[model samples]
Structure formats: C-alpha cells, structure tokens
Target chain A: MSFLSFLLGEKKTSASVAKDRLQLILINERRGSSAGPDFLPQLQQELVAVISKYVKINPDDIKVNLERQDSLEVLEVKIEMPQPEASA
Target chain B: MSFLSFLLGEKKTSASVAKDRLQLILINERRGSSAGPDFLPQLQQELVAVISKYVKINPDDIKVNLERQDSLEVLEVKIEMPQPEASA
Candidate 1:
C-alpha cells in the first residue's frame, strides 16, 4: 500500500493542498491578530502547567496556534509526548 | 510577566476559548471526512519520509489534522524535533 501510494503520487490531492493552504492562511491571520506571537509563549506555559497536572509532559512538547476562519477563531494545541520520560 | 499572567487567570480569554472550540470542531470535522482515521497512519508515514529527508525528525513527532470552516478546508501539520538526537 505504501509503495503504490508513493509511486502513484496520489498522496498530494487537490483537497489536501487546499486544506493545507487554508489552514496556513488562517494560522497566520490569527497570529497576526491582536494576540500576536508574544501571547503564545505565555499561553503555552499556562496550558502546559494545566495539562501537565493531568498528564506528564515536557513544557517544550506543547505547541499552540490560533486559526481564524470567517467569524470563528480557533486555538489549536498539539503535544508530542516524549518516550522514556513518558512516566514523568 | 509569567507570574502576573498566571495570577490574573486572563490566560483563558474569550478569544482563546472561541479559538480552541473552533479548532477542535474543525479538526474533528476534517478527520471525520471521507478520508477517515485510517488515512492518518499512511499519511503520517509519507509525511515523515518526505520531511525527514530535509530535516531530521522522528515519525512519531509529526502531527497532522484537517479543519473545515464553512466553505473552506484547512490541513494543519505540526512537527516536533527530538532533542539530544537533534543532530539527526
């Protein structure tokens, strides 16, 4: 399945490209808003503190971003859990 | 700055809540699309292969999601570089 997928180059579908582009634009728009990049570091720390209380995580593993589409704004957070230290 | 920001509890502003809710909705909407959850593992592998060629990263560190808002669809990709092995 992987090999066929690679050879066919069907991986990059139009829908996929459009989705990426739209997300990127929204992400940038949100970042450029009044909150700005400065808000992220502090936000990240707060989120990490809150989330870590429930699940062990390195503060660095937490990522937060903003997305605005139409009248709606979205805050996206992604955390990559570190192995070995997963117990912490 | 961090202490004051924390004590005030202003971190979870209205904008932040709206953003998080919208993003969560979009992410779920995109994931629930025709592509489905099965598509993610393969997509993740493909992305890891392509991105690793340029910058060293673990496949596990990469995260991707889809968001659809009104008429627009967005694809979000987030990658976390592992430390200690950062040289790779």
Candidate 2:
C-alpha cells in the first residue's frame, strides 16, 4: 500500500504535535544509553520539569524516547501511544 | 539522560506533526517490505496525494517514513529533515 493510502484515515491534532516535540529532545539527551521499555516514565517526569516553562503538560499524554532507526537511533517525543487494544 | 532535557531546545510546529502522522501510516503499510534507503522518496511522493486533501503541502517539507524501534519499526511522517550541516 502507498503511504498516502495508509495515512489518509489517521488524524493529527495541534496538542499532539506539541507533545511529540517534547518527547524528541528528551530522547536525544538519552542517546547511547542502555535500551529498554523501562526508560519512558523517567523520561516523562523530566520532561515535565522543563516543558512547564513553556506550557502546561498533561503527563499522562506524553511519550518520550529513543526509537531504533534501521539500526540507528531516533529521538522521538509524542503525546500518545498507539492505543494497544484498539489497534490490534 | 532524561528525555525532557534533550527535547526542550528543539521546536515542533503543527505542520511537522501532521507530517509525522502521515509518515507513520505510510510506514505501517510498507511494513516488512524491505531494508533500504531508497524507499523514502517513493513514500514521500505517495504521501502528497493523500494529505493534500487536508491542506496545501510543500513537497520540499515532507518526510514520510519507516523509522526503527528496538530493532523493530516505527512509521513516521514529518515536515522536514533535520538540516544536515545546521545540526551537525
């Protein structure tokens, strides 16, 4: 399937973008660190300390991390996770 | 390295997030397809057709993708590339 066909139904909102930006930088600082699913909460808490200077952040809605990129690493920050049960 | 400290400096505008959503969906469809750098452009071109329905998009600003996650994959779509010389 083409990228467009795949993305056509998904929606993007403004608040979510702000959240993603918040997540990316946090991931960057953690670069070259040990890998695991456990990294997220610590990342989220730290994000709160800094981002509060710019805007009120809803912690439950944040996602910050180091995502693999074809054997490389990508610093990503987002407002949400793909809903687990909903997507499957 | 906490996630927030890394993200505080980088800025994310609305356009970028929409692009990210676009890329993620496209990447999902392309799942398990291949391992190569060549896939990006073909993905980008295809994304333009689908997203244009929502807004006027500048092709130069688009990046539709399949990024990696812990040796796994994460679909991504964004408005631009990290400017090579500017960031490095």
Candidate 3:
C-alpha cells in the first residue's frame, strides 16, 4: 500500500508542503530572539529625543522598520510631521 | 558678532536641520551591515528550489523581506504562483 501511494503523487503539491514547513520554521524563529535586537526600543526613544529637539513631534509619529536583504540591512525611519502653517 | 548671530535664529528651521543630520546618519548606516543578513540570497535560492519541486515556478516569483519592529522581527515571504488551470 505504501509503495502504491508512493507511486502516486501526493494530494498536496510539493510547493504547498514546502510552504507549510517554511512557515513552521519561521514561527519557531520568531519565538526566539531572531525577531529583532533588544536595543530597538532604546534606539527609537533616542531618535525621538533627538528629533524633538528641533521639531515638535509625537513619539508615535516616528515609525522605524529594519529590513535585511542579502548582506545588507537597511534601517527605514518614517516620520509623520504636521503640515506647516499656511502662513509663513 | 557670534553671540548676535546666535540671538537671531538661523535662516533654516531647526527641524529642517535635524532632518538633514538624520539623513546623513542613515546614509552612513546603510554603508555598514545594518541592512540585512548575508544568508538572505542563499535562503531565497533554497526556497526557490524547494517550491519548484512540487509546482512549476520561476525563481523570481518569490520575494522575502525581513522586518524588525521593536523587539520582534518578522520574516515575510511572498510567493507569486501562477493561476491554476481551469480543467479538473
């Protein structure tokens, strides 16, 4: 029976199976420290302080996202500033 | 003269100046390894191979992006699969 089943293709495509496996691995890694470094919040706080010195901004207005591509890691910081006054 | 200059605000707003400084810092950081892990391409290739086993797919169809938000890092993998055939 096992031999006959092997001769026939699996009900699920190999791609779907591989995707499931990869998702599991990713979830496991997320549970570990692989998600991000401990200093991220600290960095965000410091950035807020520094930027606040010059511009009046809410802490929540700054969003920092780090993306790693190949050997390079890019730090993306997006700040939502209030619109400048209409006059002057 | 310097004291008088300080008394009068500089032509550029402090906010604009701060933005320039931050941009410079970000550019410098990009020149360093903060962008991503070295294994990204390898992982992408392996994923392509694995998925190809069950489904016919182009290597470029898969895109993996790792995002670090606060203390957690999320591995996001997006695969563009070809539409299924209509026939049963």
TM-scores for all predictions: 0.26, 0.25, 0.26
Residues B1-88, candidate 3: write the lDDT tens digits.
2222232223644332221100011111111113343333444445345434433455565556564333223344544444333425
Give candidate 3's whole-model lDDT: 0.34
Candidate 2 local lDDT, B1-88, one digit each (tens): 2322332334545433322211222222222223324433454344344444433446776654565432223345554323223322
Clashes of each: 5, 15, 8
Q: In model 1, which residue pairs have backbone atoms overlapping below 3 Å?
A: A19-B75, A73-B19, A74-B19, A75-B19, A75-B20
lDDT of each structure?
Answer: 0.36, 0.36, 0.34
Interface RMSD of each: 17.0, 16.6, 26.2
Off by over 4 Å in 2: A1-88, B1-9, B12-44, B69-71, B80-88
Model 3 regions lying over 4 Å from their true place: A1-41, B1-88
For model 3 chain B, where is the 10-residue window of minimal lDDT?
B20-29
